[model samples]
Target chain A: MEKNKKNKLSIVSLVKKYLPATVALVPLTIIPAPAYAGLITIAVSSTGALNFGSLDAGGTGGTVVISPAGARTQTGSVVLLSGAGLESAGLLSISGSTGVLIDVAMTNPAFAITGPGAPMNVGGFNIDGGGSSVSLTLPTNPATFPLGATLTVAAGQTAGVYFGTYTVMANYQ
Target chain B: MKNTKKGSDIGKALLMGTALVSLSSYQAEAATGTGLMSAIILTPIDVTSTQVLHFGSMSVTTAVGTITVVPNGTGGTRNAGTGSVTEIAGAGLESEGALQITAATGLVMNVALTAGPFTVDDPGAGLPMTVDTFMGQAVPAAFPFTTSIVGPATNVIVPVGATLNVPAGQEAAVAGITPATFTGSYTVDVNYM
Candidate 1:
């Protein structure tokens, strides 16, 4: 009977020794994992560039518009000329959880394209068919869309090729 | 021993509940894309002189004479002023200077001229002539004029004319070989109004 009591005591002591470590691990396992939204990623197509094509900014300046559909038009003294590097809308490919509502936006609503001549203003940024935001279509893991904007050319805009960079962002809604 | 085990289990359950409550919140994720924008701008407002002003051949006697070339259409009308001067008809085509200004349609531009009583001299030892009263057949009928580039046309042509003054007993030929030939230059300035 004395030996049995000693064994019980030793077992109790072992449980006591390990109790602190067990308690420390309990919180970690019991804490529910937070639900996470799918990560959204956006990229411009390799062959895509927002191009206004060839234009003649006559004696009086005007604006050139490139539609999301890649159609080019002009107003005022701006003349549209067809040649190499013809007008095209920028193509954006988005990848994420399908059916996730997304909000797309231009980091800079208005910016400038500069070259040998005076800088031209680029504004009125829009997505394909028009709108600042878009919803990812269902079942389409990687969705593609077009982006377009208006270019304000100064009167007597000097002759040369103008270049600039613009940024866009996509976020889970 | 039963009492001690029950108390430890109760304490662990309370801590677990607290941890679950603290960890249940949501956050948003975002991504960005960069795009290259480009454009090509062509030349604007190109001005060129298509034709030069010419004064047909003329003969002068002992009296001072003058030749007035008026800007008509593409050509000019030459009139001999009061003196012993005669125009040698069929010698050459006398035309007014033509300046072709290319720009955007419906654009209005201010036209200016650097008028000169320019001296016209020959290669030989002959009397020199003077050209003055530089004029352009433009709107407002005077210097410092303005022209509108009409639609369906990207350019406009302005005709320029002038007057030439000859001295008495002007030489008829240079080195007594070729007919006396004179040449000079003038200026035309244009700007956006």
Candidate 2:
């Protein structure tokens, strides 16, 4: 019996000495594996309308030009009637992956301006720089893009209000 | 009993040593890597007009004068008091041009107007009068989008005013019957900024 007791005591001492190492082994199975993959996304929004406020149609009539930079000029019978909301270039908000390229295109090159008088043609649409398609390098954050347009005013283009529609497309590159 | 306990201790130590070695092997095999993917989406933008701008009809006089039509009221100097700017009643939302825009929530937008003055010519007399200085007022006071939170659409009302300069002794549209119509097209551009 005394021998058996001595043997049991030695075994217990061995377990106590190894208990710390067994506990330390638990962490090896519990540590989380690291993730190595990620994804990127992009989006866009609008700010306001492009305004070409007011112009005087001289007896002969003429054309009004709005530069992509929002500069205004008049020709022929068309006189730039001075007033507020007179002229402003269109603005757009582009956002997405930082340091990425984006392509912009206009679906319609020309549209009609219809109002009280006969329908008038509004052509020569330009965005940012002069061209049908333009490319931009998107910033890491959201940014603004300016668009300008020009219209062909006809002789005796009646007197009244006019409206038209156009489309702009953007693609991630 | 002593033999049984001794045997069990040996078994336990061997089992623990095997587990420790297995754990070491797994730690050595631990490996990692990384990858990347990209995506994007867009929504359409739109604006619908609710009201048409109108500067009421006025009578032309032989004497030189001007007619000014502002949002609050329409009044300019009329020689002989015969020529005046009158207000025209209309159906629906009054005050000028009203527009509704649709786009992504919280998106910012810019409103731009470009057009010149209007002109009226007398068919019988072959003379023209000019309506110059076109001005516009937005209901919110500013042309920027305050919020797209309510929905994808925002409403805006714009009231337009203009000035008319009539040359001295300008002929009327008719002998004493009709008022010549003066009309022209204006362009409004809206976009995301």
Candidate 3:
């Protein structure tokens, strides 16, 4: 049958001449680091002046302990990145860094606000001792722009507010 | 020739194994990375706190002093931690309040029986209300600090809408209470779990 139609036209011209060099080795995905979606600006002081929607509902534990302006133990800290070549990290379940300075003796309680009782240092100007783990280090190659170091006072885990001022909170997944 | 050179050596090993699986699909799949970073930056912290303890009976009383937990017993005299308790980490801890002492002649001469959380809510069912704002400061005395229990200070961890501390060892002391010099807000709502 015409020699099997000339071998199916010589295997369709050898798959169209090596198929564009095998589709140019099938690469050219040009994402270099695509998956971008950023917006980080956690900077607070004394109830942190409010952001994210301006919350203030009776505000006590959920968070809200503004005491900015020179601060004292209402300290602060934030350092987590994620947006460039991607490699940020995880585990930041926080609960307001405890600054406990007790004395009611219903039982035994006694541990007075250590770490960085936040004395103003997050975005208002570096000063973190609020340490419990918020150090992702964000400066690998030329990337450092994913922010998050709050203190609007939600009081729980122990990362409790510090120095005396706060702002920026209400984050989700 | 030899079966056409063994079918051209199996077509050049299937064309270099499809060009190395299309060049490793453009790399970066270290089996999944939740560590995505291309522009996430935030570095500004000098000190933070969480305390974190797992054991039990821990004391810290520098002066406003008085800690008397009594689970099995053996707990008192405290000046605990100190300047941020080494800056706590991971688990979390640090909280201690209620210590009113003043003596200019207003009242509350020296009342500070540690162990705290709450600060100004409920003040019961666990303990948290210890008041004494030192009417007028001129000499009062007794006011050093370093307290931090946050975690296993006997039985920490207070959550659920939160508000319950000063329960664990239970013991009150306001005795003659009359010393004033900035005595009122000794706040301590612990646990950052």
Best candidate, TM-score-wise?
Answer: 1
Give candidate 2's chain B TM-score.
Answer: 0.50
Name the TM-score of candidate 1. Answer: 0.53
Give the per-residue Cα lDDT of candidate 2 at A122.
Answer: 53
Q: Higher DockQ: candidate 1 or 3?
A: 1
RMSD of each: 12.3, 17.7, 24.5
- The best candidate in terms of lDDT: 1
CAPRI class of candidate 3: incorrect
Looking only at chain A, give the TM-score of model 2 against the true structure: 0.68
- Clash list (residue pairs), candidate 1: none
The residue ranges of model 3 lying beyond 4 angstroms of the native Cα positions read A1-59, A62-142, A149-173, B1-141, B148-193
Which 10 consecutive positions of candidate 3 chain A have the poorest summed lDDT?
Answer: A102-111
Q: Against the hidden reference, what TM-scores do the models get?
A: 0.53, 0.37, 0.18
Evaluate every candidate with DockQ and list the scores.
0.27, 0.03, 0.03
lDDT per residue for candidate 2 within A60-155, as digits (tens), equals 666676677888776785655443444676666666555666776666676666666666555566767746578777665677777666765666
Each model's C-alpha lDDT? 0.73, 0.52, 0.24
* iRMS values for every prediction: 6.7, 15.5, 16.4
Selected candidate, larger TM-score, 1 vs 3: 1
The TM-scores that each candidate's chain B achieves against the reference are 0.68, 0.50, 0.16
